[model samples]
Target chain A: MSDSIAIELRDVVKRFGDVVAVDHVNLQIRDGEFFSLLGPSGCGKTSSLRMIAGFELPTSGSIIIHGREMGITPPHQRPVNTVFQSYALFPHMTVAQNVAFGLEMRKTPKNEIARRVQEALDLVRLSGLEERRPRQLSGGQQQRVALARALVNHPEVLLLDEPLGALDQKLRKEMQLELKSLQVRVGITFVFVTHDQEEALTMSDRIAVMNKGKILQVGTPTEIYERPNCRFVADFIGETNFIDGVVIGRDGNYTVLETPEGLRFRGLAARPLSDGTSVTYSIRPEKVRLLTPDGALPPDGLAGTVMSVNYIGSDTRITVRINDRRIIDVWEQNTRSTLDRNEYWQPGEAAVIVCPPDNALVLSE
Target chain B: MATLQQQQQGRDRIRLALLLTPGLLWLVLFFALPLVIIFVYSFMTNDALGRVVYQPTLDNYITVFTQSLYINAYWRSIWTSVLTTVICLLIGYPLAVFIARSPQQWRMPLLMLILIPFWTNFLVRIYAWQIILANNGIINGFLELIGVGRLPLLNNEGATLIGLIYGELPFMVLPLYAAIDRFDFTLMEAAADLGANKIQAFLRIMLPMTMPGIVAGSVLVFIPTLGQFVVSELLGGAKVDYLGNLIQRLFLRANPINWPLGSAMAVLMMIVLLVLIMLYFRATTEEER
Candidate 1:
């Protein structure tokens, strides 16, 4: 990705009657970046994508594409194309005609339109079925046609609204990788909107996590998953065990937090927090290690009893009860090929849960 | 003993036949029988007293093909029907789109407004149009009040067209509304995202997608308008003869009711409409390939 921005949303606020769908969202998408607006349904992710596509004009604030103010500039006049979630391929037109629609609209030369249409179909690997109508094609094929139709226009940015959402799980995964590679090959900025966090994580170069019409955080997938700045982002992106506590003081680079029960824990903080500030200490299950409690307890270790042990295929997940009111989950990878009953943690077993301060985060409540 | 499955299949067949008996009987009795009678009548001879003779002849068909009166009526009927269909489509397409695109709460009321006219009798509504279009009617009265003087609002082909359009508009709108309602409007956005302006998007996407509705509305309006004599009689002052007026005269009002000639004319009209409708569906659906 280049330093130049492909699209920018400046305090964009979109209201549908009384409901604010996108509230004061500000974002700068760099050129050639695979950026994703990730959120749950009705979190305004799709609404934000629609605003960038010029489908919905912002009720207030401004949108700029390539430094051009897109105020009241209709979708057609803008230099961007969209791949709709429905695929929206014209049922009456054949695959070739559907792909050529944009070029025809622009009044491109007939021969050139044909050539580009063929190239686009080939790009999506749909060259042999040009004469077939959209209905004649399978769901995956139709999705490719929708992609080709938009890409044939060679717009500055391609906006996709859950384009792979209609596909089955296996096909969805395949398309996610294919779409990511296609973006790299084409080198056009992509603004993808999806509710599926895994899909966003797998494809997006940077993700903007949104909720309740506001953007909670925008960062790289690693940053979003490992160092989520807020509690919602940390919870929404992946599963994490949250322990409510108050900050004590800093120990080297880690911030020390004390629970209501006076159990002390250390974690990294995205921003500096004053002493005595209430916060939630979050740590992923995979990041915590479980010991048999037969040796001397580490300084950050908590003695607990194993509540339940679920031996899923790759990992053995154990719920360790630290106190009467609190339980923390720990996942240990089954590195050994043996299936001996004694190898896995059993219920009622005494265990020590040790969480590394580097892998843990102190998120504001 | 027969297998249980075979016995069940036999019983199912008998039940299916019993269920289909009434509908089949109705079609054979009222529809197919009349069509057969008309075909036979068209090939029979009619005596001077207008009584059908047993002798088979093609004279009725020949007369229908050669006579200027019959030819003129056919042309006039076809022309008026085409005009009515076109007018209905021009008005109804937008109206249906408007209703279909309306807010969820408003759509039902708007659709109800289109259909509320059907609560009254068709003839009663046509008569109301006559009252409104007549020279001394509400329109002319308003014109005179505005000091524009009374214009010739009725007793003309224009008035007949107005009446026909008024009667057939709902037919057009209903089917178009159904098609537009079923249409995924996201396609319009897709088209626009592909650099098509509003007009281009509509022409390339919306119009073609909603074409099934257009074809249905046209047929619904055109077929009825072609056979209609009531509107022309009341609104056109019976100044010009249409196919329906001619057929009515031959069957019920002429000096010697010519049944064979009327049957031949009716059969010819049916053939023409069938061919026209087939061609229309073909032409509209050809682009789907």
Candidate 2:
């Protein structure tokens, strides 16, 4: 199943009355790939997940899973399982019963169902918890039980909708890695939907960045992060400062930008902008360097005044106000200098911020 | 000043205790005391005047045990209440689920429709059913207007059973509606995604998850049905005698001297309902295991 397509969505359009939730989306998820639909709330991510689950049928287009077209095929007949955000475990049944329910539905042999349930529970590290009800377990353990309940069926695809949203930060992080390894161990295609960018970055093999009712970009985490196709994707993925300017010169792969404040800036050339065309340069705050006193190494740097300084463990973040117009954020690695971070930079003190030219992203629109 | 504060604290405790006393006293006097009295009466023998003879005998209980009359009434009441509860559950559970799973704008109106029957008097509703079910009533007229067979919906065992079910339907629906409204529907979707068919999901997931509401609705509909006098009187119309009718006839109509028998019947009915309620609670509790 390595190269086989597990699920395919072609021109899927879903409407709720007059509102269009998913607008003619086309996607193909390969077998064993951990794919994520990352978006903010109400961006049709959950709607797309629901369509694949057969809980909601698309107004048009086809949902093909494992080479079978699911045309209004009820959820029970689908060869896919979902782990819900709330971990909707059965309250009346023990963990073992909950896990065995799917096998019972499929008419598996009683003894075999029992054995398989035990194996699934063991995989989820819930060996001794078979007899406990859902309420007896903590949030994380219940989450695992939900996973075990779904995985016991060994469906071709697994849908997870915000499965880690209810977890605390530490548990969510732990579950992130656990879920990633579990997907690898099971070797099944996973379609995870979440609005958390870091969770997607850490866990997904391919990420689809969705906004509104359309997919803005779909790529590997590195590709999406290092080179976002649009401004929204870049801003949503991580922090970056945008400076609007006009293209002044083009030198093969490098371009010179002139901000309205008359500060000449250098940035990379992606899609070349014509000379004098309005554009924006995105510069990562961490790439900015604060020049020290005494004729520092940088001879050509933007002049500014240190407006504020914040100390965070291993880094000092200083904001430099430029010509009373723009502000550039610079992160300085702490070296435990003689001057305290608070004493080192005060408001209205002259400062210089510098970064390599290639670190800036050029945008035309 | 310290003494004054202490005095205020003492008075506060007194006020709090006073606030709790009325409800406690009501429970003890109206509920707990009556149950204890029934407990004593179940063990004692009564004379013809309905006065306690002060003689310790299980003769009344023995009569209840040996007499086929009392035994049949006891069994019939239980069976009728069971049938009522089951029918209500079969009908109300789905209705509640449909309402709860419906779109947001429709939820409140459908819930109000379920609850509107309860806004007025249940007795009045039973009377209305009487008018609708009686021979040559509006129902029969309509049936004739449509040229259909006449229905025997009153003055029969089946008619009383139907009344029992109808009277208890709302009770069943309200509890079930609460359960369904609070139900996390994602579990059903999860079950479906886990490759369980709709029947399996319903039996193993939905039904068991809604057990508390089912049990609550069952008990609420059952105990009162076992002892209800109005439905049997107005709808059954003396064609058959249920436990409630038998007790009433014994004390008030058949023979004034048979108050002992009525007391005995009341005591026996109480025991039967108590046992039934216990059995239902046990059955529901086992589901948690």
Candidate 3:
């Protein structure tokens, strides 16, 4: 592993009896980076995170933290703290007491404990709540307290396991921004786990999408979203309208694909393809635009009707019936939408859907 | 509609009152009325043939405080009970923790082991202690065979204390185990991750978390130890005279004239227990807030 890595799991394996929770996974987290392990439930994301936190030991491999193999360093002795899913604040301690706990454990002087606890609490925007017990606080407040407790320890890494899962959607989004900014301000390595794809994209510096205890792909949010390496990666990240096709041959930087709807489209070569190879491609809904039947298209074209029009204030979502057999979603910005059924179009009326060739992501058939 | 609803509310209140009347009347007639009679007995004088005479005096209580023989016995009994309680807690705490921390698969079987001693009747257990702790009992016989002389164990204060602790240990273990096991284990781990060593985490986090169980267990152990007679009688024979033994003697063995004296003594012990438990509960609630 590189010396620049804060924590690294080398061929780690975890098994719970007959169930292999985490297969042999290898990952290296860079120093002071906000990394997220994104996956659906039962996908081994949390198991991998737990191994890094030392809550669990990898079954068949070593875990290195701070450039040292943590042979048997128990969770308490490790220079890392975790913000649990439920916050797991000490019920008996006041907010101040809870925050001061880590420092006090190291025999920190009483005054120093008080100072650091207050500083950590203020960092999480929870001040003057020192005397309140965990039970007295709201869920979001408790979550903040848990964060402060970990932050006050000044650990090299913070392990957050679905920290915002319990909050309502409004609070979850707000906390997403809060966590992202806090990570930047603190600049400590954070290993977060979540099944919420949007949250992973919004908060993570890099995301490792996991499935069945293995990393499908890991990359920057834009890279993973714009150029998914496989069909699962493309489908899991966001709304992508899949188009089945066959690859004929490659053009210097693109591939010409013949679709099932008797149309040929030119697209960026997602992977090397041979002549006569069957393939599939996907494009985001936002990439497809609704046009008049006479409007021009860049080789890739499908004639369809407006099945259902959802008039969102900022963007209109229309399900377009492509070739009278398939439906491709088209999202139009409210500012650019010029369709008026009474004047130009109506439901079940034929229209043309144009998708730029470069926007199509080649996927496995 | 509103009047009908109000009428039902009134009727429910009446029904609740009626439901409580039987138990409350029974307690007043049997429990409260006996205490009143005992209070009156404590003040009255007994005649030559040990018949009750309707004259009031504070003579028995005064004698209890003024006489060294009675005063020493009272303090000695209290000291032994305290010793028994301390020893029971020392041994029971670790055992309870062991059972509590065991995996779920083993929990029921281990708890059953803790409860199994109670299956053989309580008195039989006390008598079993006699066969082991007596002067020429199994323990002494073993000692003799192992080239040691017979040691004086039974009919001694230490013997009663041991029996008392052995008998009370399970009662202590169950409640403490329940409390410790019910603790949020993740909180302890959180404390550790924050920077606590194992011991500090337990002291600052685990200790305070399971305090309710400790309080309940201590009360349960202490209250019964305050007035245990069978273990004291079987192990100490006639020499061990705890409050329970005193109560028993007044009713079944002691001079009949001294019945009122023993009743007064029993009432005093009951008052002491009530006050101690009340103080304990107050302290716990204050700490909770």
Candidate 4:
């Protein structure tokens, strides 16, 4: 990705009657970047994509595409294309005609249109079935046609509204990789909107996590998953055990926190927090280690009883109850190939869970 | 003994036959029998006293094809029907799109307004149009009140067209509304996203997708307008003769009424409409390929 911006939204607010679908959203999508707007349904992710596509005009803010103000500029006038979630291929037209519709509308030379249409079809690996109507094609094939139809236009940015959402799980995964590679090959800015976190994390170069019409955080997938700045982003992206606590002082690089029961803990903080500030300490299950409690407890180690041990393939998950009111989950990978029943942690065992300060996060919601 | 499955199959067949008996009998008697009678009569001769002669001849068909009076009526009927169909489509398509795109709470009430005229008798509504369209009627009186002298607002082909369009608009609107309602409007957005303006998107996508509705509405308006005589009679003041008026005269009003000639005309009209409708369906569906 370059330093140049492909699209920018300046304090955009979109309201449908009384409901604010996108509230004061400010975003900058860089050129040649695979950026994703990740959120749950009705979190305004799709609405944000639509705004960039020029489908919905912002009620109170300006949108800039390539430094041009897109104020009341209709979708067609904007230099972007969209692949809708439903594919939305014309049922009447054959695959070739559907792909060539944009070129024809722009009055492109007929011979050039045919050539580009063929190239686009080949890009999506749909060259042999150009004459078939949309109804005759399978779901995956139709999706490819939708993609080709938009890409053939060669817009500055391609907006996709959960384009792979209609496919089965296996096909969705396959398309995610294919789409990511295609974006890299084409080197066009891609603004993808999806509610599936795994799909976003697997494909996006940078993800903007949104909720309730506001963007909570925007960062790389690794940053988003491992160092989520807020409680919502930490919880939404992946599974994490949150322990409510108050900040005590800092130790070296880690911030020390104390729970209500006076149990001390240490974790990294994205921002500096003053002492005595209430916060939530988040640690992923896989980041925690479980050990049999011996003589004295180690620093930041909580002695607890194993509440449940679930041996899912590849990993054994155990919930440890430190006190009567709090339980934290720990996941241990099964590195050993042995299937011995005694190798896994058993319920009612006394265990001490240790959370590394480097892998943990002190999130201020 | 027969197998249980075979016995059930036999019972199902008997039940199916019983269920189909009434509809089959009604169609055979009232629909197919009349068509057969008309076909037979078209080939027969009419005597001097207008009684049917058993001897078969091609005279009625020859007269229908050669006579200027009959040819003129056929052309006039076809022209008027085409005009009505096109106008209804131009007007009804937008109206149906408006209704279909309306808010959920307003749709039912708006559709009800379209259908409210159906509750009254057809003749009663035409008579109301006559009153509203007469030279000294509602429209002319309003014009006169506005200080513009009354214009010739009635007893013309234009008035007849107005009446025909008024009566047939709902037929066009209903089917178009159905097609537009079933249309996925997201395709319009898809088209626009790919660098198509609003007009281009509608022409290249919306219009073609809603074609089934257009074909249905055209047929409904065209066939009825082609056979209609009342609108021309009541509104056109019988200034011109149409195929329906000629057929009505031969069957019921003319001196020494010619039944064979009327049957031949009716048969020819049916043949023409069938060929036209077939060609229309073929032309419209060919675009899908």
TM-score for all predictions? 0.96, 0.88, 0.89, 0.97
Best candidate according to TM-score = 4
The C-alpha stretches of model 1 lying farther than 4 A from their native spots are B1-13
Ranking by TM-score: 4, 1, 3, 2
Comparing 2 and 4 by TM-score, which wins?
Answer: 4
In candidate 3, the residue pairs with backbone N, CA or C atoms under 3 Å apart (3 or more residues apart, or in different chains) clash, namely none
Docking class of 1: high
Candidate 1 lDDT by residue in tens digits, B160-250:
9998998889999999999999999999999888888889889889998899999999999999889889989988889999999988888
Query: Which lDDT tens digits does candidate 4 get at residues A1-365?
Result: 89999999999999999999999999998999999999989999998888888888888998899999988888988899999999999998999999999888788999999999999999989999999999999899999999999999898999999999899999999999999999998898999999899999999999999999999899999999999998999889989999899999999999999999988889999889999899999999999999988989887788999999999999999999999889999999999988798999999999999998999999885
**Clash pairs detected, candidate 4:** none
Which lDDT tens digits does candidate 4 get at residues B166-240? 999999999999999999999999988888898888888998889999999999999999999999998888899
lDDT of 2 by residue, B87-155 (tens): 999999999899888999999998888778888898898888888888878888899889996787777
Error of 3 at B175 (Å): 2.8
Off by over 4 Å in 4: B1-13
Cα RMSD, each candidate? 1.9, 3.8, 3.5, 1.7
Candidate 1 chain A: worst 10 consecutive residues by lDDT? A291-300
Q: Show how many residue pairs clash in every candidate, following the order shown.
A: 0, 1, 0, 0
* Per-residue accuracy of model 1 over A9-55 as CA lDDT, tens digit each: 99999998899999999999999999999998999999888988888
Model 2, retained fraction of real contacts? 0.93
DockQ of 3: 0.66
